[model samples]
Target: MPPPRDTSVKSTVIPFDPAAPNARLRRLVHHDVLERWRAADRSAHAPRIVAVPGGDGDDWAAAALVTARPHTAYLKIVDAVGDVPTAVEAVVSHARDRGLAQVKWEGWTVNPEVAALGFVPLSVPLAQDAESSGPGAGHVRWLHDGEVTEPPYYGQTTHFTCGAVTALVAQAHAGELARESFDRRAELTLWRDATNFPACEPVGLGVAVRRAWPSSPVTVLLDTERPVLLDQYPQDEQEWRAVLQRASREEAGRIGVPIDSHPLSMTTVRSALGRREHVLLLVSLADMQGFDVPHWVLCHGAVPGALVIEDPWTHTAAGDTWVDAHLLPVPDLSLDAMSTISPDRIRGAVIIGRTEA
Candidate 1:
């Protein structure tokens, strides 16, 4: 039988600093795992450690590493030697105090204690860990009284296929494409069709989507006349990519797809999502992942203060799974800031709408 819940036990939130390592945390979590946590914490959304005191007056009974997004707090690691329920209660209270909507626990194995505390199992895919057997199970407890369903998640098979995967996910969510068709073959094929050589430029991807799904309305928003996503390459490469982008713009015009020469504002994006339209946003991962790589994410839903996005690429080295990427609630201001990429502050998006009856 499991131990009874200790109401007297209280959990304390400790700010995690890799520089000044906590001796207790070091004792609880392994060295390698702590190193991984350190690397992940380099992001803007760094995690905190929640420590629960033991019933016998020990320094810690249970502890968890948690990070807060817009409307949710994600528990990346949980270590319990005493009252598990009380520790979870403290975590929930922390989330509540921050006005969060839910608490997600990344569980490696099935624990009845967490299940007893009302953490329902999420239907995530099995192949989360590419190196090991798997990152076992995932659970979530909603704090508020509302229903929020996550869109289907498909991790990009290759580094350059994020644009294709986001486009595919948007189509699948809108019932324009089959869910089963989100495979490597289709992903690579779409990437081949859409890519401006290596990266999928906004115009090229928008044109490919328009040609692939004629019924769905497609619109491209780019605030620049110069070549995008090729600043890292040589001048010759940039020239060729610019030419390709020009050709893609022409194709977009011929195909009846509107290429708006303006930045897509957050207000417009919110309004489009409200009308059940999916937007493919190009964002830099510097703030989120501590790197300045340009990536594509699909905006599918909206909460009160956040936009729900599906990032096709998972940071596997930082121990991220599909759970971390799918249905992620990013605050409006943060999304707006990240979506503006490059030194030129170039903004780009591809708006896809359902078929008109």
Candidate 2:
């Protein structure tokens, strides 16, 4: 089993030091947390905790760190703040640039400043009545700083978790945690046959995994279109299996069979693969729920070799922009956002498993 999660990781404190240079904020938080860890009667492995920051541009960056896992952290900042309809969207766009999954704000009040930013006031503790003296109250007070733009603009605070955040942070890291749970050498892979891959008309992502990495299988955790496009093309269960079998036959490793019909549980998929194969391709996506899949595809994990792509016909302005930024030329490819060892490698997004630093 992985080593026990040291709760001491939670005790580390990241302070909001306004005097520090914009680029130096991350280092300052790291030093402060490390100092706290050293002073306590705790093991050296204790995770570091940094308080989320508020502001705009470099001065307004929020702080968070991966206490349990080194080389992991989440940061956010306000891009713009105004009382316009698109104000919140601006902040959301900022978070998205860093690949953060959620935008959190104290939505209970009607601060047009907050309202414009699209902050709908989450029911999080200390979320209401920013002045309330309660547990987690400090976080509430920190939200109201000049860094937020005026009028139609608002901002979201970033939080780091050794475990999970309800939204932005959680959405990005879930896949990392899922992948980390397995023994890498076990040769696990996440597989999704065309039947489970997402599509309005059953289009598989054109990319194919090289045959050698089966032990480190990709996890196909998606909310998918069901009954599968294959059901429409193939006549029977045998034919369905034949289609996938035919596709994977020439590959070096054996493709894992239907470990689960339920499609949501990778654990069930794991059970199905007990000794037969060491990979999992858990499928799930919004296309099945009768909704356009792209908006909620964030609900899915971006696993390496875990083939999840938007239906070609479903593309939109934002989706197209995303594809252009990441895979403009094609679909279903993975690239490391960070190419070297530095915080800037992760400067924009709260990503896990994308860095070796």
Candidate 3:
């Protein structure tokens, strides 16, 4: 709307000592974040590491290369030090120097922190003439003028937690990630391809498979509905409320906000091992019994104000269809199971900013 905040504005990366008195790079997120991306699949010749900067100013930041023609690259910055806005500018400059433009940018927060920092939402403004899908769309935002890379709420890659991983699968089938900035509707359902999905990601090297083919279906080891949401998002009511309000003007009640719109404080995003994941639909305690809970789904890269609640539970398991058809008399799941249980689930919803109506 506001002429799409100018992402073209560039800034130079300030060289700072990691041990300096007031440096921002030490708190940056890219160095460690690269490990997770690499862990996804390093052997694949297509994606490989290009740069990992050091020192305090370089914290929480990493540069990577996508092994494709034209040598596509990305700069991922999470929990960056100092002003995030400046870091984003530096990234743009760095990309330009590498003979590249634009970025497949991403961030994790209820507010459009990165967007405000010059990165654009891939879905909100929508890319007018960019290629719709395939390798082209994945890296299109970085190449075109006035292109914005707004990823759908669900398909966005969050921290490497079981909840984020499971929710990614759920969003895939539910159609949360398909809406691209361009008119093209990317196929998130491709993740459901058992044979095509990456197996090493879900199970790791402990369980070696017979053969790593392009079409082998490995049973998804991650539990699809284990209450892992809190692990992924982990933000409490206050933070969630603040972020939701900043992202959109939706009714707080719809997002489970209390009448006062205040929920208890939460610990850091990090949780202890063995904490169960949050799965299924989640609503704030305040909105559970509202007369009409509006469920909005993202279509064509925007939140279409439509209500579709055929099944009470937003997520249905592979066996759920059979169970609902034969074993259960009722079509909808009980509301108790759909509400948020932890920070990960609630936080993710707030960050993605969608209503399942």
Off by over 4 Å in 2: 1-101, 104-228, 234-263, 266-314, 317-320, 323-357
Task: Give one digit per residue, the lDDT tens place, for model 1 in 170-266.
Answer: 9888988776776788888889989998899999999999888988999999998777888799989889888998999889889988978866789
Q: Estimate each model's TM-score.
A: 0.85, 0.24, 0.26
Q: After superposition, how far is residue 19 of candidate 3 from its true place, in Å?
A: 20
Which rank order by TM-score, best down to worst? 1, 3, 2
Clashing pairs in 1: 286-291
Ranking by lDDT: 1, 3, 2
Q: RMSD per prediction, one decimal?
A: 4.4, 20.8, 22.2
For residues 1-357, write the lDDT of model 3, one tens digit per residue.
222434553343432222231233333435564333333322222332233343454443433222221111233332233344445455555655654433444332333555454444333222221211111111123332332213232322211122222333224323443443212222222222211112112122101111111122222122232222222233564455344333322332233332212221111101110121112222332232221222211111111111111111211111111111110111112222223333333311211222234
**Candidate 3 lDDT score at position 20:** 38
Candidate lDDT values, in order? 0.74, 0.24, 0.27
lDDT of 3 at 8: 50
**Looking at candidate 1, what is the lDDT of residue 175?**
88
- Candidate 1: global Cα-lDDT? 0.74
Q: In model 3, which runs have C-alpha deviations exceeding 4 angstroms? A: 1-70, 73-82, 124-357
lDDT of 2 by residue, 122-144 (tens): 22221111222211101011122
